[model samples]
Target: MIFDFNKTTDISGWRVVDDGVMGGRSQGSFALNANGNGVFSGTVSLENNGGFSSVRYQTDQMALGSYSKFVLKLKGDGKSYQFRVRSSFRERFSYIGKFETTGKKQTIEIPFATMYPAFRGRTLDLDNYNGETLVEIAFLIGNKKAENFKLEIVSIAVE
Candidate 1:
């Protein structure tokens, strides 16, 4: 199933999550472009205990019973971003999948079996994601440095 941006009127379900939550000074925002794609842009700062910036989309439980991969169509600024999946709302850690962009539009395929569990940048000893449902998804840019970032997302799907 595909969540096509062109069919949505606004990015109402998306929200920014800067480091300020932990007393950091980073800033970020999410909005829908005129073409219906979602744009996640922000500045990452290492000030005041901050080291990361992200945006998350809360979705209904996604039953990926037999799906093993997630496909993302997007454009980025030649940087790396972490794709996170949460299987439960109260889970402290998320399954993370990392991908790098080439400064051009492309499709990125992330396999569930390759995702690792992590919390606050620390890798957990738990096994890779083999969950049947996903409650949330996020895109984070936290390269341990300060920088500006912009990512345009066309669609997200599972197959």
Candidate 2:
């Protein structure tokens, strides 16, 4: 699948998620440049002894037992970031992964099997995401000081 930013249908399946818990101080955040190319702009403050802060975009539904990999075009600050996905059957997530940014537009491809584990979040030994319900896509800042980060997702596809 090819995702075009100018196409509304391509972005309809996505949602935004940010800091803080439900109904709380939450993450120190805001939306930036709604009409511009940069829709998500905010500082990922790892404050209050915070380790991870992120934004997630998800599809309304998923075609399980089908796709093999997830691909996207992304640009980030001069730091590393984690890409997280959830299992359809669990509250936490079955898989989690880390990837570094080039500070430029680059294609990041993740195979379902190898990208399903992390240092945080729930754990599950899932072999394939072939038909697993696509839950969420998260960009996380690891446990550390405030990391001023930016991510512009130009496109996303499954195959």
Residue pairs with clashing backbones, model 1: none
Error of 2 at 45 (Å): 2.8
Local error of candidate 1 at 79, Å?
0.6
Off by over 4 Å in 2: 7-19, 22-39, 118-131
Clashing pairs in 2: 19-27, 20-26, 20-27, 64-131, 65-130, 65-131, 66-130, 95-116, 96-117
List the candidates' TM-scores in order.
Answer: 0.95, 0.71
Q: Indicate the residue-level lDDT of 84 in model 2.
A: 73
Q: What would the per-residue lDDT of candidate 2 be over residues 34-139, giving only the tens digit for each residue?
A: 4333334455554454445666666455654678777877666657777777655355553666677787878888787677554345555545344366766666
Q: Name the lDDT value of residue 109 in candidate 2.
A: 86
| lDDT for predicted candidate 1 compared with the true structure | 0.89
